[model samples]
Target: MNCLRSILAAGLASLVLFPAPVRAQKTGEAPGVQGSKNIRSMKEIRDEGVVKQRWDVSCGAAALSTLLTYDFKDDTPETSIVVWLLHRVDAKRVRSRGGFSLLDLKHFSEARGYHAEAFSGMSIEDLALEKTSVIVPIREKGFDHFVVVKGFVAGHVILGDPGFGNVTMRVDRFQTLWKDGIVFVVHPPDDRMIGEKRLPVAARLVPDESLISRKIGVTAPSNYLY
Candidate 1:
């Protein structure tokens, strides 16, 4: 690792001194659920600026779910973003709980999370310290909204590795971000039981013998941006 870093450092140093023309790489982001509720569907039709965003949380609380999306005017490989999540829940409105997160994808394009140490490639930690950005404070207006900042790999997972089997399924937990670490939560989105089938309980919340989150399911397209 040291040798690789030294070699990269030397090359970058030479780039500074020589300032030669550099070819650009392909543009891509990672595979992520939409992060907006206003969006009617998650089909890959066009890159219109009007597309709303929502996120597919694995486990939700109080019978609720959320999705988020972002429209790019000039979001090439050079662009980065930071998002903040604000969680908002209402006792009266048992449905449609609210929460939002913030991330920094605009300035800092390379940084590593602690877990990135496992990957053979550059972890979020290996980010160069030339252009460090801050997580802007976007106020929480409704139920949930805040800030989330990730390195270069964030967009990769959201826009890359195209899949066709996107399904809104229940899981033991939906991943979350704390102040400086990652967290797994087992809370079910507030949902009501109906008919012969009851609302399945979430494994993340607790194993209930009676209900589960299998009833409220949404199957989205794998390739959202076609």
Candidate 2:
């Protein structure tokens, strides 16, 4: 559906072309603790009343995905996420209110929100973007995002209108070859587009941060509101 594609596009457009347009209440750049960006691996991010769950990424049933999962690791029990729009969005046909959907993956709080399709303002092809950042509750006290580099070996899902058919839930990580300091979860290594850029993406990382905490069931028609 275009909703997923649009959401996906706004997410990985490009830092240079699409800087933070407007501050999406639920997403923003994370500030370092005491003014420090140096965070060690497996360090404390956030905890919400439990012990470590899994051992390794391979051990967990969850497969490697580029739809980077963010485990909330904030000092306060309450975590927040600030999602900045990376591109102009205006597919108001069938999205939630105001083209913003920010919800807590863990508990079903009254705050569960959505953005309308027409609210985004710009089409998927347009380069309008917003920088969204959110702080949440993870055993670790920082933002643990799951990034996957996607590779299309044999098939593809194209976006509609602005594009068509799309990989609704395939891309796991993002690899930015055109420039540096760009971050987005790309598709698998087999994707044909990866070759176009021919960038070297990291093969493996530590374990699954999502597994470290309780797997909060998240399903919303990929990107459409029920």
Candidate 3:
């Protein structure tokens, strides 16, 4: 009995002297599992202009509305865009086309008095030079969808997704999902220019244009001219 008691005492002393190391919990990790430190959160893409798509097939219209409302301060309604495009083509044809096309967005933007242009083979680095937010089509779940590229935050692409609200994606992931590296760039309407130049929505979110530029290895434009 004394020997058994001695063994127990020694074991308790050893435990007190050398407690097992406790693993530190990582940020964004589940209870005991180590999780990705790169976990991202959805932040408001714009202070006053994120427009969610009211219908499953209206992502293009909603994305256009978001860009016009936020970047150009146009306050265009998604329904107006939808109505305008539907009048140009049959509703059944739009449904058959899978959704509103980038061409439709271009036409609507022009109708609203914004200068819209489409470019292919534009890299994310190219996007860093843009002075305004752009609309990009990406393949999501085997379907083509439109999302507004607000700007780069750190190494992630900030997006104003009409269907999913504001979101961000890693650059590599965005590249993988981006369709043909196509970008739709829009300039503010000529008639309603703001007297004072304002920062782009992404710049407002990060507030450090130099930092974003440095992080992305490209110089961003000084201001998103209205």
Candidate 4:
């Protein structure tokens, strides 16, 4: 009995001396220790512009809306943008849920006078000191989701994840999940013109989710002077 008691006491002492490390939360503000003190976030998106992808898998649209509104100062509804993009891709309906592909995003942005380029061969080192934000599709739970890569913090990459707000993860892990290392960097026109075109009649339809659920119906599609 005394030997057993001694073993139990030692085990308890060891536990007290060497507690297990606390794992970081998977969402929201990153743990202070893991990220750098100098952090940069798109304040407009966090404010009135953050596009939430409620029911429709319009993460691409939401991400694009975020960039347009925050970076380009165009506050267009996300659902309308989704519809517009679907028409551009000839997808027919917003219910397709992420029906818009990365290629589609590039074409649509270019049509609107934005400079969008796709990068398949890029390393985290390549993103170092890159001031512009990028959109990358990450595969999570057997599906690909779109997210805006804000910048690098410490060794982790800061992401404007539509589903979870801001999140930070190590570059290796991000690269592992990022589909094909595919990244689309949307750059505003050199002339500083935002969405230099009017929204087509087809893009005017409100996505079912937006109108019925959010009750935020738009009168007409946004007119970005393309």
C-alpha TM-scores of all predictions? 0.16, 0.18, 0.65, 0.58
Answer with 2 or 3, whichever has the higher lDDT.
3
- Kindly give the stretch of ten consecutive residues in candidate 3 with the minimal lDDT sum: 1-10
| Residue-by-residue lDDT tens digits, candidate 4, 133-173 | 67776664345667777666445666665654444566777
Q: For candidate 4, give the lDDT of residue 203.
A: 18
- Per-residue lDDT over 71-93 for candidate 1, one digit per residue giving the tens place of the 0 to 100 score: 11123221111121122222222
Q: How far off is residue 50 in model 3, in Å? A: 1.3
Candidate 2: TM-score?
0.18
Top candidate on lDDT is 3
Kindly give the number of clashing pairs for every candidate. 95, 100, 0, 7
lDDT of 3 by residue, 169-209 (tens): 67888899787778888887664553232333433232211
**Which lDDT values do the candidates have, in the order given?**
0.18, 0.19, 0.61, 0.52
Please give, for residues 99-198, the per-residue lDDT of candidate 2 as tens digits. 2222222111222222212122222222112122111111112212221222222121110101111111211221111112222211222333222321
What are the runs in model 3 whose C-alpha is more than 4 Å off? 1-48, 191-226
Deviation from native of the Cα of residue 179 in model 4, angstroms: 1.6
